[model samples]
Target: MQKFFAVVAFAAAFLTAWTAAPDRAEAAASRIKDLAAIEGVRENQLIGYGLVVGLNGTGDSLNNAPFTKQSLQAMMERMGVNTRGANMRTANVAAVMVTANLPPFATQGTRVDVNVSALGDAKSLQGGTLLVTPLLGADGEAYAIAQGALSVGGFVAKGDAASITRGVPTAARIANGALVEREIAFKLGTMSTVRLALRNPDFTTSRRIAMAINDLLGAPAAEPIAPSTVRLSLPPKFNGNIVDLITDIEQLAVEPDLPAKVVIDEATGIIVMGQDVRVSTVAIAQGNLTVTVTEQPEVSQPNPLSQGETVVVPRTQVTVNDDSKKKLAVVKSTVSLRELVDGLNALGVGPRDLITILQAIKAAGALQAEIEVM
Candidate 1:
């Protein structure tokens, strides 16, 4: 009797652990750098207006695009060419806008890639050379200059009847095309405090990140200010230097906690469920009703000797299918994503049908997860 009681107690303990395994598996460890980013360390956008030349009769029509004509004339005047009143009808030049991003802490003389897009009614920008354009930041200050030959990903070839183009011909990119001239002043080492912004904001994730940092530094250096922000005060040993502190804590690993969410793309019939998604006890029935109609037209001819004309006759056939073999399936309470998916699959419905069933379940208060439809 003693041995039997001991065996029963062990089995109960094993069952309890097996039931709680799904909850423990949901919190997977993620690196701190992947969960959050250092505040103020980001890229800035720059934009400029310029001209793309050397197109083979695919440039914008000067008659329709007045801005292109005016810009060309202005450029000619700058080059000491007199075109103020001249009839300049050029089909090899197109007006374009240049754009690029300035990486954080980028110094002078560093080169960055630039994207060139046609601003006029140009058919294609292939084999075009971008002229010198000054890229300006949000402060209306010139930060970089971009000039290079464009590498268009697509081309347009027409023979009066048909044309085949693969990619966007009006947009192009130039690798290492822009040279950084002015620097955006930022002193990273002189900061007293730094904030880490969470990419996916959650209160639990924020607290976990702070705890991870505190464990690594052996001090109360990191504090969660909001769901999305974790501010860190400079410890005494760091001596006003925040770069080393960031470098040390950004590599620590912590488990990020996220809320249970189910995302559904109705257009594409795609469903994504979180690991913690669960459902209450519910019964689901899925079946499709199909009705088919077919038409067959026939002509009836009279005998050769009879004085009767041919008559046309129409025939129609119809069939209905209700999928009577499918029956209602019941899904008990779920504890994991796999169990939930298995329960839904037991209804034998496709993704499109599953989308409707999920919505219905949510309406019935059986789905314990939030449903997001796209």
Candidate 2:
């Protein structure tokens, strides 16, 4: 009997893997770095206020958008050109915000890509050249200088009574347009110890990561700092060679743990369950009930000699109907995903109906997974 039960369980598992996760059934060992990242070694955001010029009458209106006019006047004043009384109403300039990411270990004169976005009611930023803009970090310190011709992937044009547009003409990216002016002093390799922060916090995964790192070096060099972090002490042999140590650690593969979950998109009538999801023995009854109400109007007129006024009356019709093909099914506790799904299908429910059934099962404490409603 035990041998027969084992074979049934194996078959159920095989069917579940083959059908549910058709393309990806195998849970292979993933790289340690793919599931975690080193703390404090990240990118920094840089922002700057700049202007995009040379627009073909699609730039911000200086009259309605006084800020654009004021910005232009201030820039001209900085260049020693006195335009205090000049009323600039041309659509050849636009106020924009320049942004870039200062990568860790970046040095002076290193080029980084920048994103330009119009800050005003400009129709578009196409064919515009960004002025000399200094990108600032969170500390309000200038870290990079961005200046180049904008490469707008979209365009907009309005003629007489019609207009044509595509993509987003108000935003653009310039490849290698910003020069790094300051380096963020990140002493990544000089630390006596480094910490790995897990992308997902799990006690089991954290313990496994520590075990994997220790197993690689044949010593207890790593310790679990938290459920989401692991700290490792640099060995004396690896002193001043932190990069080599990190590379080895990243290459080491470990099976990352995933939580059992069922996601339901009620708007699209889509239901998805994780491989580890299960349901206890339960009975489900499902049927559809619909109620429809409609309105009807009628007009009545009396004979002219009778001296009776014409009248209009309103009537409403309502009907209630229940599906006659209701189904009631008993689901047995299944240790395999295939059996669980097969039992649910026996109820003859669609995706939308399955969402309600799953929710009901969760409320009844039969579903052994988290149900995420989206």
Candidate 3:
């Protein structure tokens, strides 16, 4: 109960401060690195099919997963152990899909983390060990060899009639399990131009970024090419050394311009309003109308020892409560987010009630910000 009130207090305080200071909110600065990313300088996804072994009677059934049996047979044949046409029964191996991300500029001999997930009806992979598997990229070429003991975060314990499982027992991860055997060719310093892609697309923010970069370098080397992209050409001094130029620009701070928006999550009754949210002069009246029904059953019996059958008599009580004492409140025109919040909070309404009130206000065209329901 205390935590709930603390959250309410925090929300009220945040609303108060967010609307009380417009200059500070608008001038909030963030580093360029957090707002944008360099093109062609990102991680690539790698995946492969492999097998997990050493499970104690918790692996995929050979009859159910024919691929696992085929893979096992092929592996045995390579090791001079022919198991073809021979009855081979085993519940200690599982077919799995191995996945990992090849980091940017990853060189040979460097290791990357790999994920192993069961592709069949494997009860658990807690004590399994991934065998020698080749991780492939989108180009259908093997790039890394992944082979390590599985590190499952969850486990499963079962009895005759009860079972308990935590997390995902069929999935596991191996840190630094895959060794890089190939590299994607991309020379950042050799490029004369590069693009900075904004994580959130906005023309105002993109323009601010270009202006900030130009002002810092004292040259018009950066330009806003699109609402979500900024083009940067190498200057004379930074030719063949774009890394230093990017490092210098990334540290420069710029305040991003965002649109005024209010997000409403109906499932969780969460309302988030931007600092720029405004409201026109509007009158809002909020009251609760509660109807409660109570059921009471009484037993009716004979007072004497006469022949009688006991019967149940049903009794119900219904009550209606309409808070007619509450009055309507008026919000002035062009009010800040703090004033709007304060006016709504004064109505003694919860978050769910506030959501309905905000929606009604938006429907009446009194809210100036865009409302997004999620």
Candidate 4:
């Protein structure tokens, strides 16, 4: 009877430890918009083909990049000059594709950064100047113009046979190189209602956001349109300007709801477990195998030097070692994160091995949360 009571006490103690809360603070719940959202504002992509000149002999050759020569000829023709049969020798210029992001509501003369990447076989774009390039938007309309000295964060040098290079040779960037010539039209105050789009859609979080906004501004102001969108009616205070209303609403803090999930990074062998992850009763076993190979050299000497050459013989040795498999551990049902970790750790498995084991367990439907490998 005493032994039975002691066993029961031990089991109770173990259960208590397994169910204990973690030391880390619980993540505060936040609105879907607070966690992730589209702020009704975004940047547009701009692209242009341009020439990078003033290179130190590292530019594309004229024979290899005929497009550069053609572009130069065309530009000269546009300036009321004719170069139909011009024989151009290009050794200090390269053809490049320039790209930039035009920010939302960008006004005229607003300067933006531009990225330039070599489109030809140029060794490097270091110390180059980008000529005036007209940047076009998705609508095929010229929206901005970019022209500045490139800030290539790399260097390249070469001799007759060998070359030394650092950083990326084909890409360079210019700070505040592109000036906005046009802006995208968007009227925030004209709409009777506005929609707030959540970056990450979660039903619980969406509902919380609607409730928080409604509680603050009253029920007649905010309503949930869907799990990912919240439609709000403009109140009298914000009737003239909705931009200020949105700015104020976005600053309101609310707890966010997250789905139970386990994210594993295969490249870095990182395992992240969510709080709500659970495990069913299961058995696990782990072991390792190692193979080793060695080479031995044997020398043979000529006997009395009777026109015989000394030879060497090579001998190869290989061995395989398999470690004893660990004892199978039985995980109980409804196992918490701590219990699951402890159970896996008991098998003396490393992170890489645990990843495969967790995958198998998830496939077997023993892990309750979603498993994601990145």
**Angstrom error at residue 305, model 3:** 6.4
RMSD (Cα, Å) for all candidates, in order, is 8.9, 6.6, 2.4, 7.8
Residue 366 in candidate 1 has what lDDT?
85
| Predicted structure with the largest lDDT when compared to the true one | 3
lDDT agreement of model 4 with the native: 0.81
List clashing residue pairs in candidate 4.
29-255, 29-256, 30-254, 30-255, 30-256
Question: Candidate 4: RMSD over Cα atoms?
Answer: 7.8
Ten residues in a row with the worst lDDT in model 3? Answer: 1-10
Top candidate on TM-score is: 3
Better of 3 and 4 by TM-score: 3
The better candidate by lDDT, 2 or 3, is 3
Task: lDDT winner between 3 and 4, please give it.
Answer: 3
TM-score of each: 0.89, 0.86, 0.92, 0.86
lDDT of all predictions:
0.89, 0.86, 0.91, 0.81
The residue-level lDDT of candidate 1 at 191 comes to 93
- For candidate 2, lDDT tens digit of each residue in 250-301? 9887877778999887776666677789888888899989999998988989
Candidate 3 lDDT over residue span 249-288, tens digit each: 9988888888889999878777888878998899989889
